[model samples]
Target: MASAPVIISAHLSIPDAELVERFVRASGAGGQNVNKVSTAVELRFDVAGSPSLPEPLRSRLLARRDRRMTGEGVLVIDAQRFRTQDRNRDDARERLAAFIQESLSVPKPRVATKPSYGAKLRRLDEKKGRAQIKRGRTTRNWE
Candidate 1:
């Protein structure tokens, strides 16, 4: 039987069909097993083509500066840290879920702020104190 859809958030759940998993040989430090078993998982999700993702959320995901995201809007995750296939699969799924969750919320607009008068005064005082210390180090006598 197929597993249930992966839940990312209360509102967002990714269907298993949208997630494509491929098993490949992992490189690095697993001795002979690395060459023998294809433990690494490559998870690919077509963010742009996915029907489940809303338009705004899709745009937000595409706006991210992650290298894993392709120009075509496909997000590729390679899981090779773990030696076991199951662990790597879970890791990839978790990462995909995390990425989706991040794009779910709209970021708050930043309010422009300036230093208060007291803060400015405190900064000026510190600068003056530093200047005074430097002035004291200068030799008074001309050699």
Candidate 2:
């Protein structure tokens, strides 16, 4: 059996066996060629089933709201921008690499912050000024 292709990223590498690639005909303005040739590449990655991904990174990827991710934790990337099968294949691989790279970095946790006293005072003063302007615009009737 042939060894799986290895995809390298900044932090980790994934085997090509973890990825599933399917070729389909792209629907667009290409006259007859589009109908005859399967140029579009559909790359599928099993985020939940992949042994290559760490648990934390897998969870982070699954937490994403991208439409490309299926309910079953499979990430589907369609590469149809290029007409040629080879180019589309390369494009799909590139996109998969990018997604894996994105998962490598841990996001910084947000620190809880409170408004400073001076900031609160400034906000109140602005509101008071706005209220005064509105009050001054009121029409007064002199009998």
Output the number of the lDDT-best candidate.
1
- Estimate every model's Cα lDDT from 0 to 1: 0.94, 0.88
Query: Any runs in candidate 2 off by more than 4 Å, and if so which?
Result: 1-11
The CA lDDT at 71 in model 2 is: 99
lDDT of 2 by residue, 1-143 (tens): 33346475655777777878899999898999999999999989899899988899999999988899999999999999987998998888888888877777899999999999999999999999999999999989966
Assess candidate 1 and give its TM-score to the true structure.
0.87
lDDT of 1: 0.94
Shift in Å, residue 23, candidate 1: 1.1
